[model samples]
Target chain A: EDKVVQSPLSLVVHEGDTVTLNCSYEVTNFRSLLWYKQEKKAPTFLFMLTSSGIEKKSGRLSSILDKKELSSILNITATQTGDSAIYLCAVDPSSNTGNQFYFGTGTSLTVIP
Target chain B: EPEVTQTPSHQVTQMGQEVILRCVPISNHLYFYWYRQILGQKVEFLVSFYNNEISEKSEIFDDQFSVERPDGSNFTLKIRSTKLEDSAMYFCASSALPQGYRQPQHFGDGTRLSIL
Candidate 1:
């Protein structure tokens, strides 16, 4: 079974502080890693990383995948109160069947002003 | 931006009752999926539908669960019998293609189902 694990299950940081969330996975055929932000309900797409060492960024949020290490990291710099949410990481494996995405438990982040 | 939409923001059903959750995926997207997240738990995939058929389904999707694309716009998931354990937020997602090769899946706000 494909599995994805995330670290620092929960974290609290002051505004403007930088935070890093980690995700590592074990799968048969690795393909891509994705990040998502969830506030109250559904998760919104963040970034998708396919190649190692290449970082994907959006505003204050950035993520990178390390294929050799079988892990990924999401960094939020200059965090604001609006950044408080559950950050999710998911891995998609290369498979003929479409049910290959595995998600981590997620990291709940709280950014206080 | 176009997105996946689900109906009935919240639904409360009694145990052993049948329930149907509906979704409208983004137009031009070729793949559709159903997933659920129990409160405080990780999201779990249930099934994926494409080309008017089921491409794959998880063990969570048993005989009691069925999916259908009755029309061009709407995809539905029907649960034959609900259990208390079934209470969770059900999300509908769609992708132009699998994440590895193409766009990532976009999710709907989700339907919160509560089984009493």
Candidate 2:
């Protein structure tokens, strides 16, 4: 069965702390991996990683994919109260059936001031 | 800076009643998708539509659920008979057509469906 799993179901960190969230998956055909931040309502797009080794970065957040290991990690530096939200990891698999996205349960991060 | 939009932020319905959740995907997007997240649960994909047809659907999208692109701008998901288990936050998402790579999906605020 194809599934995506995220580690550290929940995390607590102080402001200015650095944290790393992990995502691992097992699928038939891997296309890409994406990260999202869900605050109160909708989930906003964060990062999308498709290749291995190379890192994708934006401001204080960065992510990388390891295709050989079938895993990915999201790193957040200079964490703030605003960064406290459920971080979701999703994997898109190329299939003859259709285009679908499989999501992890998400890592709930609480940054305390 | 276009985003997907959903109607009726919240809806309350009795079990066995029919309900239609509507969404207007980004104007230039070609791929549309529907997902649901039950309270305290992870988000789950329900279906994917492209070219006015369902290209993929999960097991949860069974006979009770159906999706339609009634017009150029509107995509709707209809529940034939709502059940208590159907209560969830339904999210509509869309993405531009992939050109050699996958495009990231953008989601709406979501419609909160409550079944009594």
Candidate 3:
């Protein structure tokens, strides 16, 4: 079975702290890895990483995928309370699998003001 | 921006009752999906629909689960008989293009289903 695991199921940090969330996966025919931020409502798109070494960034948030290690990391710099949410990672298969996505349990980050 | 929309932000039903979750995907989106996340659990994929037909479904999609695009604009997931375990937040998603196009699926706010 395809599997994705995240570390430190829950974390609490104060404002201005830089946090790193890790996600590791084991799957056949890797295609792409995606990050999502889920708050009280739904999971919103973050970054989708398909290449190794190249980092994708959006403002204070950045992510990179390591295909060699079969893992990815999401980094948030100078975090704010609004950054608090459950971060999810998903892996997609390369073969035509009808776009069936596999998701991780997610890391809950609490950014305290 | 175009967004996927779901009806009845919250639905409460008794076990053995039938329930239908409705969604309206982005007008130009051709691919649709249904997913659910139980409290404190990972969101799971239930089914994916394209061209008015189901392209794929997960093991969680059993006999009691069915999906349909009743109209050009509406997609629905019907649960024949609700179970306590079925209580979760059902999310509807859609992508404007086909898979492998590098377009991420956009999700709705989700419908919280509570089975008593």
Query: DockQ ranking from best to worst?
Result: 1, 3, 2
lDDT (10s digit) by residue, model 2, range A1-113: 88999999999999999999999999988888899999998999998888899999999999999999999999999999999999999988875345668999999999999
RMSD of each: 0.9, 1.1, 0.9
Per-residue CA lDDT of model 3 for B19-116, tens digit only, reads: 99999999999999999999989999999998888989999999999999998999999999999999999999998775577888889999999999
Deviation of model 2 at B115, angstroms: 0.2
Model 1: lDDT equals 0.92
Cα-based lDDT for every prediction: 0.92, 0.93, 0.93
Each model's TM-score? 0.98, 0.97, 0.98
* Interface RMSD list for the candidates: 1.4, 1.9, 1.1
Reference-based TM-score, model 1:
0.98
For B1-116, candidate 2 gives per-residue lDDT tens digits of 89999998999999999999999999999989999999999999999899989988999999999999999999999999999999999999998875235678999999999999
Q: Decide which is better by TM-score, 1 or 2.
A: 1
lDDT of 1 at A110: 97
